[model samples]
Target chain A: MAIEKHDKENSGGGRPVAEKGEHIVARHLIEDDNIKEEKNLVIDGVDVSGRWNTFIISRVNSEFDRSFFEEIKKTVAGSRINRCWQCGMCTASCTVTPLYRRFNPRAFIYMMQLGNLKELKKYIDVAWRCVGCYKCSQRCPKQVNPAEMMEALALVIKKYFPEEVKTKLKLDEEVKKIYEDMIIGHGRLDLAKLHTYAIQKSGRTKELLGKIERDAIFKMVKDGRAFSVLRLGKPHNWSSSKEAMENYLRKLNTIENTEAGV
Target chain B: MAIEISNRLGLANVKSDYIHTAGRKLEDIHERLLELEAKGEVKVIHIKEENKPIEAETLLGWKKKIPTNKLWHHKSCGQCGNIPGYPVSLLWFMNQMGLEYVDERNQTSCTAWNYHGSGTSNPVGLAAVAVRNWHRAYELGLFPLFHCATTFGDYKEMRNLLVENKELRDEVRRIMHKIGRELVIPEYIVHYSEWVHVMRFEIAKLKKYDLSSIIATVHPACHTYKMIPEDCIYDKDIYAGKRTAVSTGVMLALGAQVADYSTWYDCCGFGFRHILTEREASRSFVMDRKIRPMVREAHSDVCITQDTGCTTTLDKNQWIGKAMGYTEQVPVMADVMFAALACGADVFKIVQLQWHTTDWRPLCEKIGIDWKKSEEEYNAYLEELKAGGKTVNLYEYPKS
Candidate 1:
């Protein structure tokens, strides 16, 4: 019987021996892609197939680039990056957090502080939804001014995650172009024109005047509210200011394009 | 439960420690501006008229002098473009009270909606625009009263930046010089709602409609108070001085049931850019955060706010809610417009409630306003206009 047991052990078979993958503790926790294996393999004249070659790509981050922090600190909105103590006050008071559980200002600031661009990359979609209410800034005990920091986050994302932003977010180019033209052309926003543009862009031009909207427009026209622009006209002395604004805008575009390597 | 208690206590301790270490209360921009004024570092346009003074407290128990007269109306583009009645209603109130103001044509829209919404303009551009507007007000010799909360907040931030950063001051000053204007910051950046708040009693005296049965919920515009929180007016009489007293103060003074709800601090979901780009988010946010709670929790008859965007969002987004089968919705309007309406201003001509998309007729009828009669009168007025008749003027300036 001892000889027979020895023979079984030498043959790589024993009474109730463990299977290849049974040795892996908490197998459910390891993702399928992460668990490396091969159906057949040889290394140094040895087969290391199946669970023998299993390995996990380490989820632990190994790099911290503090230069990103420095880049953010230079911005007017993010000048106070050093004041946050990770108290979660900003997140608690965040208007976006209630709507999007992922849009946590506290976490964003902490990640910014730690220069965790890898982790910050995950939040590109929801990061722009801050709404700029400043409730977080109001309630922040540290006075970190997380509202402005969120703006800083926007700049950083635009700079660092351009590809992701391009794919994930859609710029209302037509509306934005109209806004630019109006702000440059008249020195103020024409909501009437913008509303028309919005309706047209949304393909709701057919429904431009819903039953209620039609009545409202009729009332407005009758009351002369529809032609208010004709009455109020443009801001006084807007031409010179518009020239200066255009000059500044041109200079700004150049600087931004240069920074973006455009 | 024990963990939560410990965590809360720990947080409190940390906060107390932070405050102790900081060793000072947050500086009020007004105080800092006064110090700068003493040193001739900046120019401040003071409230120098025969103005009615109201005692309102800021967040840190600081007193704010809210001027109720001699105002320069800084009109909102959105208010002027979409809801013309917003400014007209406020102007009508000024006319009724015999207050002095300038509805100046030179006043620009502040362009903050563009800045906040599109992120097109930088801080320097914004600050330059702000100082230019302030200079215009100074040129007129009147106190600048913001008609829009977004402008008010944006100006507050611009003021902070100008006060702290000399380089920015130089840049803005250069831009101002380019426009042939000087750097002028207002002594007190007042909102029209704060004006309504201070004059609530006088408005109550002029109140023609009984709002006793009207249960109103106030959506404090986040831009009005949340931005530059230290400057906003809070009264102990209203919400124990915890909440802003602008809209709620007016409602309470006019004898309305000012109901409280869970999401009072949430944004109206105008969301600036979100309103333009992500319309669904804005619409859904207003519905879930504001409309639903006002309906379910507060049982409100109306949602009164103090900003143009808040009014528009709260009023217009109800259709989105209705499409989503949210059958309950409350009428939304500016506090001053509601006050004007309560003071028996012409609904179609002055308050111009007809411009609103929602069915505010039900709300008007609830407050004893005859919608049918008002419509008939409006139609008749239109006919008269068509027949080359002169329209009603809120203010009559004496010919020089």
Candidate 2:
């Protein structure tokens, strides 16, 4: 579904360029979206024309590695990965699927179960994009809990493809700061603050004054909800709770980083 | 609660009171269940063949069942903070029904929010917190009923891990021992909605509001239905061989008009961290999928849910939608709040509609409620509360 780019050129007075390898025999055998074919090109003063320079990227997926599936099965979250019969209920009810077609939970679970990490590797850009909505788990007839299964997928990807994740999902520093502050300071989340801060941090402050944004602000203010946020600040007697949470977070971060070894 | 076992089968002669078939305790089956989970067994359990509903009933209590003697009311942070009246309405109703209960500030939040959304706490820390909270309940001779569905699923999953896995339990025990609490899994852990469903008929008789005219829809919280479908109360209509949703059980009891709509089975989209990280996606899910459908398809007047998270999501998102220039706003309230409102509890003290973001004036007009007077009385009561005098509590005395 990611195929989009195309360059067209009329050549030889009547010959069709057939850009994107459409004229290649058994076109389905190659990844059409990824096919590399130049109508006319010169490399090192060589006449790389006609069929000489045309290249069809290999579309054939080989080696269904069950080792990754075994590794995933060992995890508590992905233990039920085998229950997916590819009914697509997970994909159907997925909240993120509607927004991003590549973030398909059913397909991810299938790839994880079959150890098709090569095929899955291509979608690394959208691999960790499950919003963790748990809608898939609810609608799944097999009780697959594809929601946590997504967590398992994320864990496996982080373990196997750390660099890819790092490059693809560039962490927004401002969103990270807002999250850290909200969770640590209050032992709770102020979604409104976090959302506004994230929008501001992303240099979208003008959207903050957009018609929808302004209308939402007025409505919240009119209903006393905006003021309620100040009154309902944080949990009372939260010093010890806060201490426990902070200690736990520190230890967890240490363990994760040590495992990541970055 | 009245479970009939075949007297001829001599189940009574068994060593334990728990029903056993083929000379095996239910815990033995649970142990095997743990093994199946470990083995990654894909075979769905044939309810009639291997372990029937009776087996699950042995682990989770029976239908029409609740502990009337005393209860350990574990307050949900989302409910106490966001809804403000949800937990108190539950306590208020329980006390009215002559059910002795304890609500302690000593008990902390379930700490499940992190595990689901934020990668904050580890498995051991969470197990320790859960056991610590329930151990206090056990000390008080009470069963714990969590208000949040996520907490219910968290407790169930954590308790299973603690009960089945020795290594995790030992780790948790070390933490609990330091906290001066022991790790003994409660016999029965449930969400508060279960108790409400079992007593729906009793609630129907006490309801003072004629709710027949109002259009209502229910969002059965995803965790409550999905986590342990066997544990939740089942209605023939809602289940239909699929997962049984609990809020509909509440609607059936209150004699409210049940609006059939799409997105009824969908999650409230409060993906804990999803909302924090992907606010746009979360908002899209709640508005386009949930709120808009309830408006267009069901013409829903009020959306009732028992999950504190779902309540917060559905109720709060309507306001967010209104701010975004979508005028169709539905008031979302906990099912117990609906029941309590129908039972003639004070709209201010019990329902606390002012704390809600979505305008509920339409619902008020539909229900023939005088919001202006209720608002004034609520303020006066707040003043009285500040002055250290007992204001009129709607259910202060036992409802005789």
Candidate 3:
């Protein structure tokens, strides 16, 4: 274990700067493959006319139209991705990868460079779990925002996947409802009401009610516990004054507007 | 609704009386076991039972075990400046417990508050702050002791960087080396609660006053909960036994009725920048989101928090809520309340019970704490409140 830990520390060893000529040669080889693929497709006369093909073409065109590649280049201007030399220091250092086998920071960058959107979307959930912790970002030999890139990929998934977007929208609405209720209800929380609302939104109200009843019945029938132990009720003064409620609402509005960039 | 039925019965909402009865039966059995133990029906092995106990020298030692020397002191700028007595209280407690530790002025604020709030400040800035503070501890030849969770977290981040990024580690070291310092990660970096709890048995010797009636609630800070789970040592079942993460454990040990409430673990929402830049969202999270529910549902007389930031969010923001029109005043205080209680001080004066809920002056008077003492007496009380010693003038601790 000690030897392995030591090896992990010295894994990348140090920066390995490639010669200018070697980088140029590698770039030409990549470009040559692109040309060869285009030529083969033309000669074969095989029509790649499908939904997947259309999606790929549209994604490529969108990137090309706004020079999205240039934006990415600017974001990682200080990064040493070009000098990466496939060191795998980032993957080794990433905490997320240990939990999520599919999340490979180095592989994601490589795929992004090749414009592989379909493959990127597969790990959208993994990206959303970044938590902006910056452990991976700090450890990156290339100084890449692996977490940010994951977030971007998650965004892309949200954009392209309609069902995911709808689910997210519903969750956001539920969150907003909680915010609104608190603001309008007198700058205080109504726990019972909030729990009820959350349960109803999640479509778990019936199940939750059942669980409560089962526990209460069991306690009464088996151990003869006091009935008072199961009380779940709203406070007497459930609502706040209109002015106080309004102030909270105003604050919520300001928060929403700020978050929305309005 | 079924909840109404449960509420009428004064029980936690559950399916039927069966489970509640079973739970009660289990409690009865547990009580019987305790009874048996008390009567010597159950023989318990013990290393030693003392016929006579030694006298405690300090007020802090009354409730906290003190190590003669080693302490992982986590730093907290907000508490140091705003509630200056909190650290002073700990220092006094340490002295009372005969613990030896070091507090270095050269250490910078964790800066985690700023970084967590604004994405603009990168890990490098946070790591830099951590390295500088750790270097100060190294210079003192003492382990770093962090009072605040953010400080502990920032140091943890620095430790990660040192382990993972050679370049970043080298950069941090170089920066410190230029200032004629070498940053050393402590063998242990801990929250103050953990330190106190670790010494609970010894500290139990100093309890002169009984505090069993004061109903209290622990409001664990989000940063502490999320950043360092291991440091929190509270048991969930026994409200009083719930660990240091919530700051209720010591309260429980002191004989306070620890209330169990939903949203007990919610963030007080004092993301420093959130309060300054996004005041509304911040206040909403605290007043509307966190405190209100706990106050109404928990049946707690006071809510104790560890972080000065959390305390300010819940304490100062209560006035903001009042101005906004929320009438429910729930007093929010710090673990200093526990320290105060342990010192045999009047509960109302020492706990700053007036700060708990708005309009608590009447409550303080009702509780027999003199609310209108002379300025000198008030300052002395506050000094004693912080130092966990006899009351002294406030200006004794030099201003930085």
Candidate 4:
């Protein structure tokens, strides 16, 4: 069976519609099937697969997916990901495959081109395992960024998966709060207290409660792990006065309120 | 002074700007050399063949191996404090070789990691580290031996100051007096690698086993390479020799087949501050380019290094790469590979040396290292590492 190239003009041109300081041309050109084949979808002088047109059209049609495909296409066009001719060099050069046979970088790109989001989502967790070593990208024959695509796939997973997104967001919020407290409140580290506060904020209350039953938590309690956490290192005597603290707090509150759109 | 301020703030962007400025200075020096060549003030002689007299005895000469009576050891704070076994391994190696070395607790750390990473580049701090270390060596009646490349480079700067500025010595003395410290000088301050290389014959006596089949590569620490180029004796004929000079030279001399590959001299991505602050950039340099190619393609079993920080980057960061899905695990070790071979340590113990500065028990057990007969101190250290569990703040602490 002969492969049929999907017409991307029906969705939108993958390229930018307007050039800088130039008038926008919204006119759509209709072409015959022969003319469509003659028009090259060459990226970086290499003809891309007809599958990319189908992928682009599918993305443009989804109500919430406006410009999502365009953003990915821009990255692909910029980094030359679509220029890949399915050369197995990247997969062969990849270090992860030898160790983890489940990780197939070439298959990932193939699935991406086919617009297989279900298969892609299944391997979303594997993307984080990429050390950004760039061996695949560096050795890529077509200069496709398998690493960047993996990162992009991870972002898509985080966006679509609500439960996973919530857990990660909570962790991020807790970490940010700790960082804010360190820089704004103390201006230095209090190792012991930081550990206690981190545990408390992370909802390890069950673990804290378990300590009461197990008797394993005695060393931590009696050793003043709770009280002395603030005194693990040299105490910084210098701190903002009450007036300065209030001023700082007001500025912080303003920033938070602005962030919350209040 | 501006550099110092940038460093204290842990501003990597500012640090790189200074590095670029230093690069420009080197370009200026190259321009001067070209200008001198053009002027006819300097005569350049290229002799195709100049016959020089070589003494018959010198060709076959062997120096008497004397047990090193005393050594003034310079400390790497990052390794000595955090990766405790780095100093311990060096001491163990020295003792096994019957070298008398003193670990002077009074000598403050070189502090080069902080100063250099911060972009402060304080000549005073570098000089203090040198003078203090040299004084410790003098008190112990031993030549100063530096384990870290930063300490070696600092001492080299101090040597320059001693020769070029008498007033600097007085300033050093004044600072020492204020700090209530003694100021001792050294006749010779050298890197540990250099000391080991020089005593190759003595080291040969200690090699009880051979690993000539195991292919190895050396990652020469950048501070050692760039700071004092003359002191980097290993990479001189790095590409030309059967084995690259420094890491391969020591390994080859101890009977290991060293593989020659591209990027042998590349930085291990532990550019002190770069590894700590700009982790992605640092890991990119190592995982993307160096370690992955050596392990996966070149098929080298191990990569050896001299500097403590370089060893840590190559070894500990292997896991980071695995977690990140960058590469398969490849064992990274130190020049202590030779020390392990010398002491008749089993392959397990040699592999254990892979984590010379950190906990090696997990690695040792993986490789089947029998800890039962090993020293109690080693076992205790492993236990501490297992229980004391710590997390690194990759964003907060600059890599050293």
Top lDDT prediction, candidate number: 1
Output the worst ten-in-a-row residue range by lDDT, candidate 4 chain B.
B51-60
Error of 4 at B195 (Å): 1.7
lDDT comparing candidate 1 with the true structure: 0.78
Writing each residue's lDDT as its tens digit, candidate 4 over A106-192 gives 877665565566555556546445566778888887778776766554445555553654554565446546865664556566655
Reference contacts preserved by each model: 0.00, 0.00, 0.00, 0.00
Evaluating just chain A, the predictions reach TM-scores of 0.67, 0.62, 0.39, 0.39
Encode model 1's per-residue lDDT on B65-129: one tens digit a residue.
88887788899978987788899988888888888888878877788889888789998989988
- Interface RMSD (one decimal) of model 2: 21.3
Task: Put down candidate 4 lDDT per residue, B92-124, tens digits, no spaces.
Answer: 666665555567667777877776677676676
Q: What docking grade does candidate 2 earn? A: incorrect
Off by over 4 Å in 3: A1-262, B1-74, B234-246, B323-325, B345-376, B379-400
Cα TM-score per model: 0.58, 0.52, 0.46, 0.45
lDDT order of candidates, top first = 1, 2, 4, 3
TM-score of 3: 0.46
What's the lDDT of the predicted structure labeled candidate 3? Answer: 0.52
Model 3 chain B: which ten-residue window has the lowest total lDDT?
Answer: B51-60
Q: Candidate 1 — which residues are off by over 4 angstroms?
A: A1-262, B1-23, B388-400
Tens digits of per-residue lDDT for model 2, B61-147: 333234544667788877878888887788778776776667766798888888898778888988888888888877765667788
